[model samples]
Each structure stands twice: as C-alpha cells, then as structure tokens.
Target chain A: MRWINVLPGVLVTFALLLPAPAAAKTELYSALGEEAGISRLMETFLLEIAADERIVEHFIDTDIERLHRLLTEQICELVGGPCVYSGEDMVTVHTGMGISHAEFNALVENLMTAMDAEGIPVGAQNQLLALLAEMHPEVVKL
Target chain B: MHTNKFVGVALAGLALAVVQPVYADQGRFIATGAATTIDGAGGGGIVPWATLSSYAEEGQWGATASLTEVNVDDFALSVSAASLTFDNRFEFSIARQRFDLSTIGGELEQDIIGVKTRLYGDLIYGDLPQISAGIQYKKNRRFDLPSAVGAVDDSGLDYYVSAAKAWLDGPFHRTWLANVTLRATRANQTGLLGFGGDQNDDYKLMTEAAVGMFINRHWAVGMEYKQKPNNLSFADEQHWRDYFVAYFPTKSVALVAAYADLGSIAGLDAQEGIYVSLQATF
Candidate 1:
C-alpha cells in the first residue's frame, strides 16, 4: 500500500476528534436530586435488587435499612451532594464477598432500572454509573 | 455458484440461530449493539463499528440476522446477512449483496465472509477507546461484466481496524459514541465492479467514521461516512455518507433509516437516496 494514500484518512480522523457541541454541566448532585432524590433512588434501587435472583443472595444476611442508609450517603457524596458517606471502605466491606464481574454488572443493571423508574435521565444515570464504575476493582475481588 | 453461496450462508445462519443459547447476563448495556452494517458487521448502516454483535456473554454464544436495502437514484442494493459472536470476543459473519442496476440493465451479486475480534479496551469502563480488528473476504458472482470493464480479479479482501469511545455524561449531558476505522481495500464500487481494476491493482487505505447522540435510551441520531477507492477508471468513486436514525423498541429488534449519497457509480451521477435496515438479535 502506498503510504501517501493514507494522508487523507489521517487528516479526516483528526478533524473528527475536534470538539463537538456543548452540553450542560453534568452535576451529579443535581442529576440525582441531591439528598431527597438520593434517598428515594436508594429505596427504589434496593427493592429492585431484592427482587433480582442473581444478586439477592448477597444481601440475604445483611441489614437492609443500614444498607440503604450507607448507599444513600455513599452515592450522595460521590455525586457532590451535601451528605457525607459514613459507610466502610469498599475493600473492607467486599473483601471476603467474592463478588464477580457478572454479579456486579447485574447489580448495576438493577440500579439503572431503579433510576429509570425514578425518571432519571439517561445521561445522568450514565454519569452516576461512571462514578460508580471506578470502584469495580475494589468491589469485585474474585 | 452465486446461488449456492447464498444458500450456504443462509443455512449456516439458520443453524446458528437455532443452536445458540440466548442469555440475559451478557455484558454491555441494552441498545448498545448499534445497527447492523451493510457488510454484516455490528455497526451503523454503512460503516462497521467497534461494537460487537448483540447476544453472547463470556463463555456463551450469540447470533444476529439482518436485511438492509439501499436505493440510489438509478440503482438499488440489498443485503442479507447473519453473524455469530462468541464470548463477546470474536465474531464470524456472512453477507450476500445484490446490486440491481436499473440503468445499466444487468445485476451484480457478491458474497462476503467476515471475522472480527475485540483487540482490547472498553467503550464505557476505561479511559482508552475500545479497539477491534476485522477482515472481509469478498467474491463477485458475475465476472463477465467486470472482466470486460478491466477488473483484474473477481475476489478481494478488506482489512480494517476500528476504535470507538462512548461518553456517558461528560461535557455532553447526553450519551454519545464515536468510532473511527481505517481500511485497506482493493474493491471497486465496494465490489460491485469487482476488485483490482486496470487503473489500480493495489489496495488503498480509506477511512470510515460514525458519531451518534442518544436522544433517549431507545432512540439515537447519527451520521456515518466511508471513503472509497477509485480503482475502476470507467467511473469516479467518491466517498459515501449518510444521516441516520436508529431505534430499538426492544432488545431483540432494531430499525434504522438513512438518507445516503453513494456518489457516482458506472458513470451515473448523484446516487443519493434512501436506506433502511432491520435487525434481529438473539
């Protein structure tokens, strides 16, 4: 192949990399409805998780109410809400849990469903997911 | 020969559809399969995307079937394809294309066998873009017309590498994805005129790209562009482009519509018209 013929292709690719139209600031706190919305989201999310057969076994022995509180606080803080996360670090909590990527993905799916039910926009939901995805290494020990 | 090839591919597709077991635990979110490309790969209407075909999970099986139609001003192209993906890592596909030459008074057909593999990266999880490499083997069914027009060979191959990235909620407050591909091909008029013409027998590097913004979880609007090589001196081959909308009412079905410009083909100018495609995944 002639290397010169590839010049146009290279140029076009760089052009596509330029900035696109602007979007609104993705403030996680605003997207998740701050404190009240986070609380409701956690409630709905827990219900969905409890109903799911795949990951429900993990929560069987755990305290439901405490789990809700910790989740609300963790999500709130992660998304820039005023609430502080008082839950234990992810590694300490999930170390012996032997969580797999499939189980984690399932839980995330349930979370997405709960957010959808609460009328959270897809973009905001993805924003929240992006933040949570960072904890995959710590949460999926197995 | 062409009929036999088509039958073989169709039978293979049907067999995979029947044998493959569908699973709910497949990774990658819903509606992320994009649309089936004309070449039977997972992508937009015209261009192959970095996304894998729908279905399949780690250590599991998945399959897809699609029909696509492209109507230009003077001609029409229809494609039927089936693909099977393994473990969300490797994909094998076969597609048959029929070119109805309304103005030229004869039809041309071709069969394509393709394979694609996810090399590395993730569309959403990692900072790096998801990358994939693919190849397509193409054979034209009719050789008389192409041979008379100075085609050197009836069969050819295309090799490509693609990179894709998806932004969930970055600067754009909406979900968006972008993909870029570089292909080396000797196909003329995308193999309608056969491969390796008298003017250019060597494969040329070309570019293809797609960018999409999700209006919602089920609907997205996007554009795709694919550059072509002008191997046949009989006519000028220009870049292909389209503006499209894709909708997924459910995970198993996707519909895509586009207005596309295929440029000039066999001296016919302004081959701009409508394109529509339907895909079913399992």
Candidate 2:
C-alpha cells in the first residue's frame, strides 16, 4: 500500500492504543463502595456462585461464610481498599482441583452478573475484572 | 451452485438447533466467538483474525451459519457460509461467494474451504495475545471472465497467521480488541477473479488488520483493512477497507453492518458501498 493510504490505518491503530483521558481515572476503591460496598458485593457474588450450576460443585463442601470473607478481602486489597488478601495464593488454593478453563470462565461470568446486580458502572466493572483476570494463569489448572 | 455438502451441514445445524438443550454447555463468554469473515473464516467482516467461529470452549462443540451481502457502486457480492468449532481449539468452515457484475453483466462464483487452529495464548486472558494459523482453498467455478482478464489459474490457496488481543480496561474505560494478520496468496480479488496472472503468479505476502472497541458488551464499532495483490494485467487491484459496527444481542446471534471501499475491481473505479451480515450460532 501507498504511504498515504497507510497513514489513516496507522493513525487508527494508534488511536486504539491511546491512553484514557485524565477524567477516566476514577478511584476503583471508592467506585466499588469501599468496605460496606465490597462486603455487600461479595455477599451477592457468593449468592450468584451458589446459584450457578457450573461452578457450584467446587464450593459444595467448603465453608461459604469463610469463602465470602476472603473474597471481600481479596477484592478490597486488589482495588486499593484498606485491606489485604487474607486467603492463600491463587496457585496454591487452586492446585490439584482440576479446574477447567470453562469453569474458570463461569466463575468470571457469575462475578460479572453479581457486579451488574450491584449496579456497578461498566468502567468500574471492567477495572475490577482486569485485576481479577490477571490471576487466570495462577488459578486455572493449577 | 456448488452445494451438496452445504445442504447436509445445514440440515445438521437445524437438527442441532432442535437439540440446543444438549449443547447448552457451550461455555465461552458472550461475544468471544468472532464474526465470520467474507472468506468464511472466523474473524472480522473481511479480515480473518486469530479467534475461532463459535463459543465452544473446552469439551464442547459449537457451530454457526451466516449470510453476508456487500453492495458496491458497480458490483454486488453475496456470501453464504457455515463453520464448526471444537473445544475452542480448531475451526472448520465452508463458504460460497457469488459476485454480480452489474456494470459488465454476468456473474462469477467461487467456493472456499478453511481450517483454523488456535496455536497459543488467549484473546482476553493473561498477557500474551491469542495466535493462530489458517489455510484456505479457493476454487473459482466460473473462469471465463478470469481467462479474458489474463488470469492463469482457476484455484488457489491462502496461508495466514493471525494474532488477536483484547483489553477489558482500555481507552476511555471501554473494552477494545485488535488483530493483525500476515497472509500469503496469489489470488486476484480474493479468487473471485481467479488466481495467478500475467503480471504475477507467485504468492505475494499481504498484511491485514482489525481494531475495535466495545461501547458496551453488546455494541462494538471497528475498522478493518486488507491488502491485496494486483495480479491481473487487465485491471489494477486495490486494497480493501471497511468501518463496521457489530452487535451481539446474545451468544447465539450477531449482526454487523459496515461501509466498505473496495477501490476498484475488474476496471471499475471508485467502487464503494454498504455491507451487511447476519450470523446464527448453534
């Protein structure tokens, strides 16, 4: 292709990679409702997990209350809230569970549904999902 | 109409639809199964990306049927295609294309068979981009126009490698996906005008790409570009481009509309128009 025709394509690609405007920098911790919001969200998320047939089996024998608490803490820490994750590392916790990628995606889907039910904005939801998705390799098939 | 195999597959697809409950475990997330390309491969409207056709994740089977129409200034193209994916790892697709030469009269037709395999990575997970390799065998059933235009072969093969990636937290806090492809081919106007030519018979390397942003989960706006080889000596072949909007109302259906500029084809200049496609995933 000629340089002129190629220019627009290059420009559009650069536009795709462009950084978000300064106004997009909403604090995730605050957007997710801090301690009270995180706690409520975790409760809703656990409820979703319980209802989801795809991933419900994994938690059948586990303590629901404790799992909820650790999840809240993990999200709080990951989103820069005033807390640290109290649970074991992702790899260690998921090791030998034989979790498939499909099951992992189901968990994520349920989480998204929970976030939607909590009325979280799309931006904030994506921010939280990004943080969690980083743990995919560590959690799946570990 | 080169269609016996397509009839069987279409029937199978209908039966699968009737038994949708049995395959309800198609586990991939919404919008992960990319749209079928014009050439019948899984990807964007025109540029095939690294992504597969349907939402079949691990231990699942998924299939899709699609119809695409592109109306340009002096020509019109209609494509009917179907694809099947397994375990999100491999994709097999078939397509038939009919090009109406409105300005010059008559029609040209071709059939294509494609296979794509996901080689590495994930489109939305981890750091690395999803990578894949694909091959397409194109057979032009109508070769009279091609012969007059100096094309040497009625069939050809295209080999391509593609990589695609998405960022959930992209610019403006909206999700975005980008794909780049490298292809080797000797096809003239994607084999509709036949393969090889008086000017060039050797496969020429080409680059294709697509970039899009999801305004929300169901609505996405994007652009695609495909570089072409000018093989025929009768008329100059130009690159193709389109800007499109794709909607995923649900995992089972997608609608895409675009404005495409085909530049020139078979001596017709400034050929540009609307492109529309509908896809049903089963």
By DockQ, the best candidate is 2
lDDT of 2 by residue, B1-282 (tens): 213433443454444434434346668878889798999999989899999989899788899999888889888888999999998999999999999998799999999999999999998897678999999999998899998899999999999999988888888778888899999999999999999999999999999988898987888998898999999888999999888999886777777878998998999998998887777888
Candidate 1 chain A: minimum summed lDDT over ten consecutive residues — where? A17-26
- Chain B alone, candidate 2, TM-score of 0.92
Output the lDDT of residue B191, model 1.
Answer: 83
What stretches of model 2 exceed 4 Å from their correct place? A1-4, A11-26, B1-23
A-chain TM-score in candidate 1?
0.82
Best TM-score goes to which candidate?
A: 2
Highest lDDT scorer? 2
Fnat of each candidate: 0.22, 0.55
lDDT of 2 by residue, A21-127 (tens): 33322398889998789999999988999998888999999998899889999888888888988889988999999898999988998888889899998989888
Question: Residue by residue across B1-282, what tens digits does model 1's lDDT show?
Answer: 233433544454444434443456565566667778888888898789878888554566677888888878898888999999887789898999999888889999999999999899876666678899999999999988888888899999999998988766544556778889889999988887899987899989988988777777778887888889988888788888888988776566777878898878888998998887777787
